[model samples]
Target: MAAKEKLSGNIIQRSAIFLENIGKRFAAGIEELGYVMVLFVECVYWVLTGFRRKQPVRVAAVFKEVREIGVNALLIVSVLCLAVGVMLSIQGIATLKQFGQELWVVDLVAQSVTREFAPLIVGILVAGRSGSAITARIGTMNESQELDALRVIGINPVRHLAAPVLVGMMISVPLLTIVGDFMGIMGSALFTGTEIDMPLDVYIQRTFEALKPDDIHQGLIKASVFAIIIALVGVSNGFQVGSGAEGVGRSTTRSVVLSISCIVVADMIFTYFLNIGTLT
Candidate 1:
């Protein structure tokens, strides 16, 4: 009887520990979310009040962020989207040829690139690249006590650090998405002309016919939201970093993972609403 009782007690103890850990994790996540929201509010407040003498934005920092997050990322975005275009065209051509509807490959590539692939691919790449960089940079500063120094000098760290990144991301990501869209279309056109016996002018005309203004708008909107998510999550993780190089590395990893997860969830929500509207 004593042995059986001990075994039951052990099971209960393990269960309690598991529940406790889960609760702790849940509480931590909630707290982190609250902190991020507060930071976002603080950033918006700073931007809105920037014209007033009470809170002037650092314009130079904003410009620097724009260069870093957008200009520096252009080549990679173009290359990746170009590859996506080629692959998409190849697959689309193969599938449509079976039905003797290969001309519709233009529609497939144009609509898919503008409405879905370009924005999503750009967002994911930015999260992995720029998002991780933001986290590492901020985390390093935190570890080195530079953030504390800023606070000591009466600087609001969020305003000094995060606001520029936020503004830059909001502006740059959509621009990058536009570039990606153009490049992707160009790629498809090139492939169709070189490999599929389609003329360049004909391909271009068909592609434009297949594309709508709404498709471009939706892609830009999604890109903007994704930019916000990447910047916020990256900066938040940076501020949450512990001490040492290890902390910086861990924070960077978390930033990428969290940003991508948030982007995907937001994409799903946007897609669902858009489809619902279309159906109605």
Candidate 2:
């Protein structure tokens, strides 16, 4: 009887511990969400008001961020989009040929790349690259007490650090998405012209015919939203970093993971609502 009672007690203890951990995680997530929202609002406010202040808009900082976030990422974005385009054409050609509708591959590649793949691929890549870099940079500053020094000097860290990043990302991500879209389409064109024996001009004309203004607009909008999410998550993680190098590393990893997850969720929401009006 005593052994059975002890077993029951052990089970209950384990259950309690599991529940406690879950509750803690839930609370932390809620707190982090609140922090991100507040920071986003504050950064927007600063951007709107910064011009009227003594400092005005930080053009130099914005330029630096643009260089770091956008220009640095161009080559990788091009390569990935090109690869995706080639793969899409190959698969699309194989499947459409089975139906004797190989010409439809043009429409498939163009529409899919423009409307879905390019923006999403760029967003995920930026989240992994620039997002983690932002988090690590700020976390290291936090660890080294540089943020505290700024506070001591009466500088608003959010205004000084985050506003420029937000603006830079907003500008850069959409432009990068445009580049990615072009690269993806070019990749499909290359494959079709060589392997499928389609003429270059004919392929280009078909692709242009298959694309719509709304498709491009929707992709740009999604890219902007993803940029905001990545910047907010990255800056938030940076501010929340703990006391050491380990804390910086942890925050960087979390920033990348969270930014990517949020980008996907936001993309789905945007796609659903944007398509809902046409659902008839």
Per-candidate TM-score against the hidden true structure: 0.96, 0.96
The local distance difference test score of each candidate is: 0.92, 0.92
Candidate 1, residues 74-192: lDDT per residue as tens digits?
A: 99999999999999999998999899998899999998998899999999999998999999999999999999999999888888999999999998899999999999999999998
Backbone clashes under 3 angstroms, per model = 0, 0
lDDT of 1 at 71: 95
Please state the error at residue 151 of candidate 2 in Å. 1.8
Q: Per-residue lDDT for 127-216 in model 2, tens only?
A: 999999999999999899999998999788898899889999999999999999999989999998888799989999998898999989
- In Å, residue 190's CA in model 2 sits off its true spot by 0.4
Give the worst 10-residue stretch by lDDT in candidate 2. Answer: 50-59
